[model samples]
Structure formats: structure tokens, C-alpha cells
Target: MNAPPAGLEIRPLTIPRTIDDPDAADFIAMTHVRNLVYAETSGHDDGRMAPAELLPNYAPDPAEIRYSWLVLLDGEPVGRVGVDVPQEAGSRVVFWLVELRRSVWGRGVGTAAYALVESTARAHGRTVLQTWAEHPPSPGDRLEPPTGFGSIPLDHIARFLQHRGHQLEQVERISALDLRDGLPRVRELCARATEAAVGYRAVQWRLPTPPEFVDGYAWMKSRMNTDAPAAGLEFDEEVWDAARVARADAKIVDAGRTALVTAAQHTETGELVAFNELVINNDLTEATSQYDTLVLSSHRGHKLGMLVKCVGLLAWLDIAPESPRVLTYNAEENRPMLDINEAIGFEPIGYEGAWKKVLSDPTTAGADTADSSDSSGS
Candidate 1:
């Protein structure tokens, strides 16, 4: 895809995280605007990570989230994005997240960059690419999202995804796990477990995911992924086990994000039932540090979720005691999980909607032709 007219130039942008600025005011102003944009669009203002985290992600064994971009003309940064593509052993599909600057609406930056993402997928011969998003603000919604967390709407971004033949297949809610007051007792944490009668057990899988278990982990992912709540699911739903998990690790570290934390549970039958993850610095959106969590259906009855979650919760909190929260998203309709959330004091912040388009390439589907032949032609 080519750039549209009006003196627009779309070039991949880069920044060095190691450098510091002498213009404290401009630096702070840029950050403030950046933050303002964030609160307006995504709903949170990440004031941490000093203004320098906005650089090329190139660290070894990186955090869980990663960023890459394309800058527009006029230099104020029209559109840039962060992607999390780590290869973890037990995962099935490759995932990505793209955040755009709203100023460039109607511009081609999104279309072009989306094309690039497609090109990369083609290069790898991958089956699907997954993205997570929130519902858009309402008609009379204010510019600033409230202090809590919520789903960003899919209205605006959906147009782009729909234009590309993407459709919403599922929706998940994002929730935060904060340990600001320190973790509750282990017994208190264990009270939520559903494992006793089911013979299921949960435990935190430590960093440096053990190599011997990779293949089996990859095997289960295909059957494991629940549907995405929004459109544009681009990965194959296949059995995942160890190899998939390994890919997640390599993908993140390769992109300068870390995949250092995880928790999982197994039945006495040795079936992998539940899981959640805590990233050291993969995501930098919340003013305080945060992490992501995942739970599977097979493990739902066992209270393994709370059990598995608490491990990673206390784990990250133990390491970065200064951090405020660990973030996770559950489907808005997911009430059982919400029960566990309320017990832990995770508050609501913002809300996002999920949408999907079932049709693609409308022209390919055969459009009705307009009658251009006028009687005057006779």
C-alpha cells in the first residue's frame, strides 16, 4: 500500500531508551500529551517508565509486551504501536496488539501498517494473528476515561479490521491484580481452590520454563483457546503444548519484552487445567506495573484459578513490591471469574466493546452494479 497525498510520509520510527533529554519541560510536555492521548483512547495514563521507554525494544529476554511503529508527517507522532509476539511453549496462536494515535483518523497510516503486519504474517506462513482491544467510548462519552480499567470500544478500529475482512469471534475482559497492601496469607489464598474434590492442583510455574515439558504444553493449546471477543482473529486454532510455549518466550524476548512469569495447574490425571502469567515490564500502560492472567475451562471448577493466580500475584509483588497492580481481562460475561476478582479487591477502571464483521471483500462477494448507461447514450 502507498501513502495518500497531501505531503504525508510514513516511515518506521525509532527511539533510543538509553538517552536522556536536557529539555525537561518539552520532555514532560510530550509525555503529558502522550498520556492525555492515552487516557482519551485506551483509558489509562502510565506515568511510570520515565519518558525514555519510548524507544526501540531490543533487550534480551525482554518483558511480555513489545512496541514497534510508523511515524507520520508533521512530527508530533500521528500513529505508533506496541506488539506482544513472544513464543511460549504451551501457546497455540501468535498474538499482536496495535495502538494508533487518533489524530491521523482518515489517514492511511493504519491501512499501510496493517498491510505490513499482513506482509510479516505471509513471510512467516503463520495461520492466525490475534489482537486484544476494548470497546470505544459512547457518543457523549468524555475525553478522559475514568480512573479505573475497562474495555476500549471496537467502533473506530473495527472499521479498519472490517475493511481487511476481520471479524469479531470472541471477547475477554481485562482485570488488574494489585498487591499494594502485600499478599494475604497462603491459607487465605488457598480458600478459593476448587481442586480438593476434583483431584486437581494448581501451582506457579517458575521462570525459564522448564525445557523438558515444552512439547506437551504445545499439544494442548489448539483445543484450549477460547474465542476472541472482537474481530480480526488471524491465527489457527490448533492443539498447543510445549513447542507453542517456547515460541511465546522467544517471540517476546526477541521483541524486547519479557515472558518471565507464569502459573499453571494439573489434574491428578496429569491434564493441564489452568494458567496465568505475570510480566515484569512487558506492558507499560498502567501508572503502576501490571501483569496478565489466563484461566482455562477444564480448570474452572477447581478454584485452581485463584490458586494459580495467587502464586504469580505474590510472585511479582514479592519481586517488585513497589508495583501497584497485575492486569488481566476476562470476558464481560464471565461472572464466575468476577467472583474471584471481587474477593481480591480488583476494581473496575474502563469499559470497551467488542464487534465483528462476518463478510470480507464485499466486491468479491459480487456487488450490484450501478446503471451508468443513460438514455442520453442512445
Candidate 2:
């Protein structure tokens, strides 16, 4: 193994009550580094979030046990590490990430940071470890997953994962839509989808979901884990109820972000069968992010996915006109969803690799680790 950089230390991150708390300095600094690393990798600031906008995500939650650490190099914050263990019964999956600045690449910082991630998972009794990393377009040989829907450059990040025994299980496409182009196409698509969805109608609302729709929305949200294309990665079927839905909404509102949910309801039954989400930062200038978009399996073949997405985008235009673009991600193998995105002017911006590693023996994992120079930012 390569020698770790001098003065390297990974310390637990303290979750403050608010961004203004005195203990929030490290968290705030880590947030800045996170944004900088994202901008460096994506070549844009669309993913940037203010310190206040990111604080809520780090706060304690009941659904998952989250562990975070601040990577310090000679007492200066240089990177961040995170591990999340789901609370579902009998779950063994753990998701993790190690993100460092470009200047720290080629050093052993990422490898050392990942050591903490692996140890935390083992301590939590997790056997399946998964992580997602954006592999920006680079001139080099490419790696493709079994799905064969997309490929990522066999860059430094890829080499790092391969060295650590992680397999590239899936590829996700990062897409963007320019809202500045106006919403005429979205309107057209919404109309056509509405026509095709003969028995459904669009229902829209802001955060703090309406009482009548809460149960249905929660049910659909839970289905996202089971219905989405996950390839070889493991996912615990999440259990979401009204309480969980409320907590999720509160988190977004507390973060000073705005979320608009659009769903397609079966008019006759009044059941929410499909849904899409659009979220914008406190700063309206930042790009809007398209969150989970799912349609129930029983409700497929009715153009509900397109209906919800189109309806959501159209509503977003009125909600955050200052936001210039909308960003989204979809599994490469999800051809139906991709077709809708492509037809609606959402262009491919980048690709992300979903990697997985199953530990046969936690005590013996990573015994042959090597140094790698890569930024694992998802």
C-alpha cells in the first residue's frame, strides 16, 4: 500500500442543531469542499448548494443510520466520507462515498478514506457495499456494465474501484433539460400524455403533501426501491408511511429548498399511481433537480411516467422561473423512461457507475488495498 499523506485524519462530523451553531464550522467547510469537488468534476456549478441548504441532509433520521466524517490533511478539511445503513428489517446493504478535491487526487487520501467506510459497514453488520460515482467524459478506454445501455471511461475512479474488488454493476445517465427554452414542448407532451392516460389525471402539490394524497404518495415512494432498475446492486424494500412522508417533507423544507410533487391519479379510484418530483435550491438561480419518478407496475403501459414528468416540469416552470435548467438521473436500462426524457429535450450530460462489493469476510476485506487517485462524487 502507498503511504498515506502526512497529517491525514478522518474525524467524525458533528451534526449541529442548525447551521448557525458553533459546532457547524466543520460541517460548513465540508459542504464547501463538496460543492467545489462537484463543480470540478462536472465543470459547472449547477449542483452547488449553500451550507444551509445541505445541513438538513446530515441531520439524524430514524429511517437510516448515517455516519459522516471530515477528512483533514494537516488540519485542513480536504474531503468527506459518508456511510448509510438502512433500518429495514434484515437489511445488509450499506451505501458509502468518499469525495476529495482534485488537488488531493493521485494521493492515498481516497483509499484511506474508503477504509473508514468499509470498517463502518462491517461494524454495522452490512455485507453488501454499494457506491455511485460520476465518471465524466474522458478520452480513454471505456467500461460497460452487463446492461450494455451506457459506458464510462476506465478512468482513475474506475481503476480505484477495480483495485478494491468492486464491480461496475450498472450505469446511470445524468441528463439535463434547459428550462430557458420555454415549456411549449412540455405542455405539448403533457397534453398528449393526458390523452393517452385515458383514466388518469395529473395532481400537483408543494411540500407537506395534502392529507388526501399522503397515503397514496407514500405507497408509491416505497415502490421506488422495488420497481426501479438496480442491476446487480442490492436494495432493501423501503417501508414508507404517513409519518415517513412527513419527515421527508420536513427535511426538504428545513433545508430551505422547495419541492413540487406531481402525480397521476386514477380518476375513478382516486389512487395516485405515478409521481415525479422537482426540487430547487433556496437560491433560485441554481438548477432544479428532478428527483424520484416512479409509476406503479400495475399502472404501467398507460403513459403515466411521461404524464407525471411532463406535468412536473410544466409546474416547475411556474414555481421557479429563475431556475435555468433541470437535472435528472435514470438507469441506462430503463429505456421507457429514457425515451420520454429524450423526447422532451433532456440531453445526456454525463454517466455514473453503480459499483458493488460483497464482503465474504469483513475482517479480511481490503487486505491487499492499493493507492488510487480518484474523486468519488455521486
Candidate 3:
């Protein structure tokens, strides 16, 4: 870090009244800062897809209080911080995200910004505040990514969090599937999966989930939380129903994104037994993100996960022919999902470390120890 710049400042930003509202001045400035920092650390520029631009897709729950801040140096934005207060009563955890330009990383900008964030959390009567940081692979770790793109160095954020009392909670593998390379293999696997998935068939729709399967889809969505492999992270079984599914579909549509869903239905009972989602932002030329892929335990033996994913990918190729890649993250310990991804030629690219710090009670809460942050960003 260079010599500390003078007069560092943290300014609050207002959330837009509606997604269509013109970008607020502060929000635009923060997005620029985030883009610069992201390019510096990740070696890629995604200015077009900055957080401010994607806010509508993830609008907070009605009862959740959200805050955004700009970290400025000499009156210029250099970093960003975002926080969300839990909406439910008896919940003490507050979720947050932070980023600082690499040039100003060690000069206390992140620390000062986090101080303000902590103050805000405490002011909300929240007891725990947690954020995530990605770490670069160690020297001994395998490297398969082509030159230039590689793991983000873990040292900087690791040291920063440890200095502030955060501890490692879980690690997830960032994996990618090269559509062009896997197209043939995907078809082969899909064929096998179809044969193995006898007595079951798939249903799919673009954005809004079909009305008839909303309830079954909701049930599977809730089961996704409880049935997956979650090793060390604290998580809660999410409450899902038709209403939440409808809202989620609306959010996806509002964001100008298309969701290609391929779900396996139990032909015998007409229930959605397994499902997977592939989301493509308006920019069909870039990589698509793969969201939740779940199969009820009772429906697990039929290879439905692979069947649904392959079908979804095939549909994506037809709809977004220009797409180059698909990205998905799975807990490092989730061998089953990883196995399916690997079978489909999804290669390892990087890793993300989930960190947590529990705040001690103010009357005695240390505000440093981490014990209450949920690992899955709940």
C-alpha cells in the first residue's frame, strides 16, 4: 500500500426507489469503485454487471433493512461496502460485503470502512456481522487454468480478517464447464441419464415457473437446503412455498434475465422430484451462472441431477448460441455434486473461503470473535 492518502471518507448511499429509477449519483460512483477493485484483484473487468446494476434481481425481503456505502479517498471513490439486517425477529446476524482497490488495500481503507459497517450493525442491535473473502491457491495446490487467470491471493484478505478476529468457516470450489468442449460429452451423458431416469420426465420454462408445478418446485427448493452437504457452516432449512417461488420468478424477469429450468418429474405421482436452474443475464455472449441443482433423496438414484443439468445446458446452447461457458460453485466437500460436474467436464478454476466473526455483547460482546455468521450467506 502507498503512503496513506489524506482525509479518507465513508459516505452513505441510498437504495433506489425502483429498479427503473436512474442510478443515484452515489450508487454509480460506488459501482465504478467496485469495478476498478474487481479488475485489479480478479484480472477481469465487469463494469457492465456491477452490483448496483444487479440490485433489482436480489431485492431485499420487505422487512430487511439494507445499507450501501462508498469508501472515498481525497473525495474520490475507492471502495464499497454493503450490509443487510436480518428481517426476522430473534435473528442476530447481519450479512455484509466489502471491497477496496488493490492500490489502497493495506492503507487502512478497508479497515476504516469495516469499522463503520460494524458500527452500523451494532446500531441495528445486531450481534453478529459476517462477510466473505476469496483466497488464492497455495503453491502446492494444482493449477489448470490457462495463464493470466488464476486463484485470487488469499493472503491479503486472510490477514485482514484474522487481524479483525474472523475465522475460516468453509471453502468452496469455483468450477467452470466449457460448453464448446463438453457439448458432445454432455449429449452422451444426457442420453445415458435419460435411460437411467426411466419412469421420470423433465419439464422446463423460461422465466416464470409454470403455475401447475410451483408448489412441487417450492418443496424441492426447500429440500435443497436440508439435503445438500453442508459441513462446517451454520445453516437453516429455508421456508419455501409457492408464494416465494412466484416472487423469485418475478425478480428474475425484472432483472432482464432468463432462467432455463429443467426439472425431473415423477411420472407416477406428477411431483417435481428433481430440478436444476441455469440463469443467463441479458448478455447472452458471456458465461451463464448455474444456480441451485437439487434432487430429493428419495429421487436420488435415477441420475436426475445429471439429466436435468445436461438438458438445461442443451437448452441454453439452443437459446444462447453465443455463450462460451457456465460457472457453478460447490462446497469442496460436496463430492456428489462435484462428481456430476466433473463427469460433465466442469474443471476446477479457483476456491472461495467463507469467513466469520461473532461480535461479543457490547456490555461484554467483544465485537471481534466470530460465532454467529451463517456460512451459506443466509
What are the C-alpha RMSDs, in order, of all predicted structures? 9.7, 1.1, 5.4
Per-candidate TM-score against the hidden true structure: 0.61, 0.98, 0.85
Better of 1 and 3 by lDDT: 3
Per residue, candidate 2 scores C-alpha lDDT tens digits across 106-223 of 7788878888888888888788999999998999799999888789999988988888888999999999999997879889998989899998999999998989999999999999
lDDT of 1 at 12: 43
Top model by lDDT, which number? 2
Q: Write the per-residue lDDT of candidate 3 for residues 146-190, one digit (tens) a residue.
A: 222223343656656666676566667878888775499999999
Q: Could you tell which candidate, 2 or 3, scores higher by TM-score?
A: 2
lDDT of each: 0.47, 0.89, 0.71
Q: Which regions of candidate 2 deviate over 4 angstroms?
A: 363-365
Ranking by lDDT: 2, 3, 1
Model number with the top TM-score: 2
How much is the lDDT of residue 140 in candidate 1?
Answer: 38
Per-residue lDDT, model 3, residue 77, is: 82
